[model samples]
Target chain A: MVGVIFKHTLRHSWLQALYWGLGLGLMALLVVLVLPLMDYNKMAELIQNLPPFVRAAVGVGDDLEYAFSTEGMIAVGFFGKLALIFAVYPAVMGMRVIANEEDAGILDVVLTLPVRRWQVVLERFLAYLATLFIIAALVFLGLWAGAQLTGQALDLSKLAVSALNLLPTLTLVLVFTVFAGALFGRRTVALTAVTLFVVGSFALETVGGMAKGSAAEGLRSLSFFAYFDALGVMRSGLAAANVAVLVGAAAALLAAGLWAFQRRDVGV
Target chain B: MVQSDPIIQTENLTKVYTSRRSQTRALDRLNLSVQPGEIFGYLGPNGAGKTTTIRLLLDLIRPTAGRARIFGLDAQAHAVEIHRRVGFLPGELSLWRSLTGLQVIRHIANVRGMRDLRCAHQLAERLQLDLSKRVRDYSSGNRRKLGLVIAMMHEPELLILDEPTNGLDPLMQQEFNQMMREVRAEGRTVFLSSHVLGEVQAICDRVGILREGELRAVERVERLTHVDFRWVEMRFREDVPAAWRERLGDISGVSEVSIDGTTLRVRLQGDFDPLLRAVSGGYIRDLRVKEPTLEEIFLTFYDGDGKRAAQPERVKELA
Candidate 1:
């Protein structure tokens, strides 16, 4: 039954997933195409002289020195700065899982079937997780395609690792939306809450990076974006500890969502 | 063991919808039972908790204070197992509008782990539904037909339909009635909720009337249709007499009497022979005796004081 629902969800949503994947991939490719046309040494100087808040918003941290490199420019400008926009796809997918269906009264039909409530939620989540992986793979391909097009001697492994890092953070956002959906059982409420969380996390991370002192740092630690070190992973390598935290949080949210959904009235 | 038990039963089944401001007791403590091989019509007006009771039985919503059982199993605890044997059509049917009707059928069929599409295709053909069209393009009637097809294709042992004939034309309704009769013939049970009294009278063996979250009466259809009340219309040669209206009202078993032009209408209950004997010698042009509609019969159960004069033995407890 779980597999049936999983396949059904995939069949209905494959087009939406394709659009998100292609759009993000194209953006990455376009950024790579324009990277080499400018002088990085001057660009890096300008980025450093800019207001700290503005620089942080564009994902330029103390690693402005690496901002001169092709990998750094693409990582900061495309991946890090626009991470919230990429997170929107997962947010929408998560809400659509249960909350949107319940609001539409479609949950009434599905629940009357021989399948359990938890299976529907779990299977749909797994389907979305699979689509997220596909989107990440497409993004890596886009970065690789740009490297080939620009004739830059970039390490493909590093680009692959950078793209894969988006998964943990994106999964966290997706499951958080699912959690809110199960808890609230209203599409508008769940979507509003998830959007606030995503947008707020981005703003806090950017402001915390610019402000001085422990209080500011404490606020940054509270933001999910604080754990997603996109630039560091692109420039260096994968961090196991950060990935574990994100995955652990995502698993917890999903479990809580299943528990709430199983216990609550549907289509109320 | 299952054959001896009621196909559907509720013991003090209750549902209360609550919010920040107020709480509505949607379904009061309802105790009802429907045996196998009978079509049990759950009759009620809108907002009368018919849908609420059905939702409770399906376990779509939890009850505030009681439980429902199906096939001798707890509805909430063994819902999945019960669902395997039950077919349901919601009062307000909503499907995945983006998918073609065929796709929706295939999806639900797959979910039920059924490989065959023969039953689904047959039902669609019988219902005159085009499965190739996307549901968004389907008219309201077509959507209802699709819902019916989906609910019956699995051929479950129990069919729970809410407003099953809404939006269907007369021809389609007749066909649906025939389908229901066939299901009954196969010795399966159907628990359908409807405000359409004629459909209930035509197909149901028994009915339970619900009013404002309370089960008012449960009786066999034959008994209800044969309830003593009836309407008698007579055309007299030159108005009979103005004083006869008062005289007829004075007789036993005669309720309301009125004369409009040359036609005299009388509401009668029990033996009509007394009224017939009184009017036999009159210069009458014509006479018509009409059976009371289920609606009228139901009105008798909800009198001005909200009390039914002739309560069935089983429903006396509710009274």
Candidate 2:
């Protein structure tokens, strides 16, 4: 009973999961392979010439020393902007899990079974978590393989830490979309709302990085993207507190989804 | 017959849906019961609360007031336990299009904790459904057949079906009726809702007629059709006089008397004693009595100015 809905959801989503994992993994591999071709001294000089606001907005380090490092290149090039593409998988899946079924009138059949409504929502969420885990593992393995082929000094532990760090941030988008679906019970409404929220958060994070003083700090604290420190994880290992925040936020969103789903009438 | 406890009961069950603009009472203060080992037909027109009552019985939606029970257990509180023994086929059947019919059946069986799929295979065979084809390729009738198989596979104690024969062909409808008879033979209860008066008349032991969110009548099928008015035409050897027509019209349970040459046509209700006495005269050459169809009987509750509709005298009042 624990995995009844999980198995059904996985059966429907395994192909999409594979496509996303391969796409993200391939991007990571290409970024890692192209890292060594650039001249660090010349790149650092060029970066240093930019204004401080531009540097902060683009997530360039103050000294430009780590700009040419394998960890730094992968973090900024692969994990930062490109990782946003992975959010689409969870977002689409989260909306489909409940809202699509309800809109199609299939939830009436599913809920009439002996299983409780919470079990259906929770199991589908767990399936999405499993999917995110697989995608992260693929990215980590791709980076490891790229490092092996190029004979670079890429630390496998650092790559693993940085790749795995994407989970909590991606999960925040996933659970938020799920919550919207459970609360609204309409696919179009959930998709529109979640897309707007994710895009706004990304915009806020980018602008907040450029702002000065407490303004920048406050805006960064408000954005979910700020908790995902891929560069920091590569350089100084995993940030336990930041991971905890993302995990805590995701947990709360999932709980809220289950609560809303249980209390509301399905297939309305 | 020995009396037993009701398998399904609703106590003033009501559902009022409130949108931002308006409020609609889908089901209003309905009190009904279905005894064990009987096929109870819930007959109503479209939007007449037939589906609403079924949904409430399964706890698919919350009631605005009152409560529903199955086997003495509250439907909302013990939904899971009640569902374990109740098989439900929703009016609008929607399935996972990606899975084959067999796959869908297997998934439901597993979820219901039934390990063996022999019953499902048997049902599919009887329904003439191809289990290997994906549901997306299935026609509406095929999808309905698949829904029926999924609902009946576990041999539940109670079957709640909403328009079960909606998309089936005539031949398939006969088979469905036969299947229901078999379920009753096994002593399981069935609650079926449909707007087709003939279908309900064919198989139901008793019926509850609903109109505009209210229960209009609940009566045994025999009693319902028995009390309905019949069309009677009498032909005499000689021309009938106006006085005889007036005499027949004056009978307690007869109305709409018309006389033409040697023939007279009239509608008769209640006991035929007075009409029989009138027809016993020697001038009558032929007398024909036509029993009204179930549809005609049902229309007595509908298609009226509300006040002129004739009510069934034997129908039990809602509790």
- TM for every model, in the order presented, reads 0.91, 0.86
Each model's fnat?
0.80, 0.77
Error of 2 at B10 (Å): 1.1
DockQ of each: 0.70, 0.58
TM-score, candidate number 2: 0.86
Residue ranges of candidate 2 with Cα displaced over 4 Å:
A61-63, A214-216, B223-296, B302-311
- Judging by DockQ against the true structure, name the best candidate: 1
Clashes of each: 0, 0
